[model samples]
Target: MAVNRDKKEPVIEVQDICKTYFMPGGMSQSVLKHVSFDVMPGEFVAIMGHSGSGKSTLMNILGCLDRPTSGVYKLAGKSVSDKTDAELAEIRGREIGFVFQNFNLLMKRTIADNVSLPLIYQGVSEAERHERAVQMLHKVQLNGYEDRLPTQISGGMQQRVAIARALINNPKIIFADEPTGNLDSKTSDEIMDLFTALNKQGITIVLVTHEDDVADYAERMIKIGDGRKVYDGLRAEYQKDEE
Candidate 1:
């Protein structure tokens, strides 16, 4: 859907974003072209695409990891197109929390330490960070696993820890890149349920994955192919096609 960015409020607005890269062997590839989308303050959206569908490129732009080759991006009503690298990094750290498919936990660290990582970067006091991390772990239903290393837990439990770590700092939006990609169906369902619960508590979520099975967890889904959006709307339509 085309979001009315000129409306009174929009947490994230992108106008005609285009991302291209120069591949080796004297070839340039366009991954995203004139892509536009908006994410409201508390919306949970999903982006679905095939391997080369440019979803990852869009995720990078939305998360401010890379600037668009040409186009405008506004975050929290402020234009972010011209931010310096340091400035962009600051915004990313403050406004966004990222969860990856691999769980991205530190094996040597306990669950408490992993959840404390983001706050530590923000300069929170060590004692307070530990306390907040413990709280977040509890929020994700990992009440008594604070001392467990990443390897000591099941894959699903580790993902919950990752989710807790993402929420420890209470970011405005959480970007999950194929969060359940590595888990079995049962485990994937559990992880998606956690996402649903988080959304209920008002954290905007944007997930990227090629698997429709995973994307079904979100209320809205956008499908892409050949670097352009093919569909964007309720999941019911995609479900109909599946049937």
Candidate 2:
């Protein structure tokens, strides 16, 4: 699907970012090298790469989970490269939603409690938390499962709960890292369809996937190799190049 992105300010802007880790004996391993990209509002973008391609490093930086060794990252026009760890956490809570391959729900907590965890950090009242948790559960079609434990649900349903948790804050952008990795094909397709529907509703989605079928769901494709972006273009153009 070709999405028509309007000419608006980018939701994410990464400029000349690099990440490196030092090893024993004064050795250093560079994970990312001068990587740069921008994700516009309401765009669905996939970052694809094989293992050791540094795509994970890039994703970590983009999701605010880790800071780059050098360069600038601007989330919603605010530079985040120099922010303290505490400041970055604040920014993450306010601006980003994250979904992971392993649904990171608290096993002991009820679905409602898990979904409302973010709001707790934001100091939302208990009444508001309950109300918003129910609302988000409805959004993800898990309305009746609120009181159930996460282990009681199927894998797909657990992922849905994770999605509801991610949506509780109404974030400006969503970062999904191999979101369907553990699901069967049919369930994967359903989850991707849900992501498509969300994108259609004007949510900016940045998905990281190694599977071509998974990446196909995105309107834009970005391939990273050896710590650098090898391709950044429309999905159609990427298909042509692959052919």
Highest TM-score, which number?
A: 2
Clashes counted in candidate 1 amount to 0
Model 2 regions lying over 4 Å from their true place: 1-7, 239-243
lDDT for model 1, on a 0 to 1 scale? 0.87
Which residue runs of candidate 1 sit more than 4 Å off their true CA positions? 1-8, 239-243
Cα lDDT of model 1 by residue, 54-139, tens digit: 98788888889988999899999888999999999889888888889999999999999999998876789989988998899899
Total clashing pairs for each candidate:
0, 0
Could you tell me which residue pairs clash in candidate 1? none
**Candidate 2: C-alpha RMSD after superposition:** 3.9
lDDT of each: 0.87, 0.90
> Cα RMSD (Å) per model?
3.9, 3.9
**TM-score per candidate, in order?**
0.92, 0.94
